[model samples]
Target: MKWLKKSVLLIAVFAVGVVSGSMIWTSSANNTGLVDPNRPGSVNDPLITKSYVDQAVAGQVKTELEKQLQGQLEQLDKMLADKQKEMDDKIVQFQKQLDALISKAGGMTVVELQPNQTMYADPGATFIVRNGTTIAVSTDANGIPDVTGGKDLMDGTPIELNHMLIFPREGRGIKSTHSSTVFVMVTGGYTVMNPDGTIAASSSMDNSDQNETAE
Candidate 1:
C-alpha cells in the first residue's frame, strides 16, 4: 500500500510540471507576436526606406551632371582664348607686311650733303635747301625757291620740304657755290656730284602715300 501511494504522488507532480511549462511557452509565443512590427530586427522593419534611397540616388546623379557641365564649359573657354590670340597675331603680321610694301613703293629718302657738294635735280622736280640749321629756300613746281615754310620749323619735328630750289636743265646743277644741305624729290633718279663734277651718290625717288596708320 505504501509503495502504491508514493508512485501515484510522483505521477501527479510530473503532470503538474508539464501543464505549467506548456502554459508558460504559449504565453511567451503570444507576447513575441504582439511586439511592435516596426521595431529594429522585426520582420516588417525597413533596413533602408524607399524615399531615402531615391533621394540619395538623385543627389549622386546631380553631382555627376554638374561635374560634366563644368568640364565642358572650361574646354570651350580655353578654345575661345586660343582662337583670339591666333587672330591677334595674324593681324599684327599682316600690318607689318603691308607697311613693308608701302615703304618699297613710295617712301622718302634723306640725304646729307657736305659743304660745296652739288646735287643735280630733274627738270620737273623740286628741292629743299637748308644752310646751317635753317631752310634757306624751298622751291616750287616752277623751279622757284623761297623760305615761306621755314619759320614754322618746330624743334625735333621732321623738316618736310614739299618743294624747294630747282636745278636748271643744263646749267651748273645747284652750283651749291656756297656750303648748303639739299633735299631733292623727283619722279626719277638723280646724281649728286662733288665739287669736281664726279658722281658722289645717286638715288631714285619714291612716292609718300599712306592710306592708314597701323596700331
Candidate 2:
C-alpha cells in the first residue's frame, strides 16, 4: 500500500506540471500574437532619439534663417536703388541751376555805334565787329586780344570784321571810324560813349569779377 500511495503522488505531480506547462505556453502564444510581426520598432511610434530630434530641429532653424537672410538682402538692394535714384535726381537739378546761372552771367547782345562813337569794355569783355569800320583804343600797350587772329591790338589798330576780340582790362575800347555806323556783338559788360565821352548806354557788372579771356 505504501508504494502505491507514493506512485499515485508522483503521477498526480506529473499531471499538474503538464497542465501548468500547457497553460503557460498558451498565455505566451497569446502575448506573442498581440505583437504584429510587420510592425518592428513602431511599437512606441512617438518615442524618438535625441539625435533624431536635434537633426529635425536644426533643419527647420536653418530653413527659417535662410528665408530671413534672403528677405534682408532684397530690402537692402531696394534701399540702395532708391538712394541712387535720389542722387541722380539731385545731380540733374544742380546741372539745370548751373546752366541758368551761366546764361545770366554771360548774356550776349548787339550794340550800334555811330561815327566817332566809342564803346568802352570792362575786363574780360568779348566783342565781334559785325559791320562798318572800327579801331581799337587802349590806355596801356598790352591792348585788346584778337582771339580769332591770335594777336594783340594796340591803340588805333583797325578792328577786323567778324573776328572775336576780348578786352583784357578796363579803359580798353573800340571807336567807329569816321562816317561809318558800326554794329558789334558784345558779351559781358560794356558802356557806349559819344564823341564827348558821355555814357550812352551801360551794362551792370561787378569790378572784381574776372573771366578767362583767352581761348
Candidate 3:
C-alpha cells in the first residue's frame, strides 16, 4: 500500500507538470501569432490594398505632371516677355528713323552774299543784311530763321544782328550814279536799286507777308 501511494503521488506530480507546460505553450503560441506567416491577420499578410496602391501612384503622377506644367508655363511667360521687349525696341527704332526722315525733309537752305553782289531771291524767300554781309533766307516749320548759327534778331538787346539793311551815312543822300536803274529781285516784286544804293519797291509792300519788309 505505501509503494502504491508513492507511485500515485509521483503520477499526480507528473500530470500537474504536463498540464502547466501545456498552458505555457498555449500562451507562447498566442503571442507568436502576430509574426507568424501561417496565421491570419499577421505582419506577413498583405496590408497594401489595390485602392491604396492606385491612389499612391496617381498622387505621384499628378505631382510630376503639375511640376512639368508649371515649368512649361514659366518658359512661355519668359518667351512672351522677351518677344514684347523685342517688338518695343523695333518700334522705337522705327520711330527714330521716321523722325530723322521728317527732319531732313523739312530742313532749309542758306546762301551767303558779299558786298555789291546781286542774287535772285525766290518768291517766298527773305534777305538779311548783317555786319557787311548779306544773306538770303527762308523759314522752317517753326517759322524760325533758317540761317546757320543765327537767331531771331531783336533791336536794343545788345544782340548781334544776323540780318540788316543798308542805311546811308550822314549828309549823303542816295543819288543815281548809273545810266540805267539796277533791279533787285525780292519775294513779291522787283526792287530798283539806284546807282547811289537807293532802294524802291516796284509795288506796294504788304506787312502781313514775312518776306516783305519796308526799311
Best by TM-score: 2
Best by lDDT: 2
lDDT of 1 at 116: 65
Residue ranges of candidate 1 with Cα displaced over 4 Å: 1-49, 108-215
- Each model's Cα RMSD: 18.1, 18.6, 21.3
Model 3, 1-215: lDDT tens digits are 99999999999999999999999887887788633664555566756688999999999999999999999999999999999999977975674465445436644222222234333333344433222322232222222233444554222122123332222111111122223221221222233332245433223434344134223
Model 1 vs. true fold: TM: 0.32
What lDDT, from 0 to 1, does candidate 3 have?
Answer: 0.44
RMSD of 1: 18.1
Q: Which ranges in model 3 have alpha carbons more than 4 Å from their true place?
A: 1-46, 108-215
Model 2: per-residue Cα lDDT at residue 172: 95
Model 3 deviation from native, Cα RMSD in Å:
21.3
Score residue 190 of candidate 3 by CA lDDT.
31
Q: Rank the candidates by TM-score, best first.
A: 2, 3, 1
lDDT of 1: 0.54
Q: State every prediction's TM-score relative to the real structure.
A: 0.32, 0.45, 0.34
Q: Any runs in candidate 2 off by more than 4 Å, and if so which?
A: 1-106, 205-215
Error of 1 at 8 (Å): 34
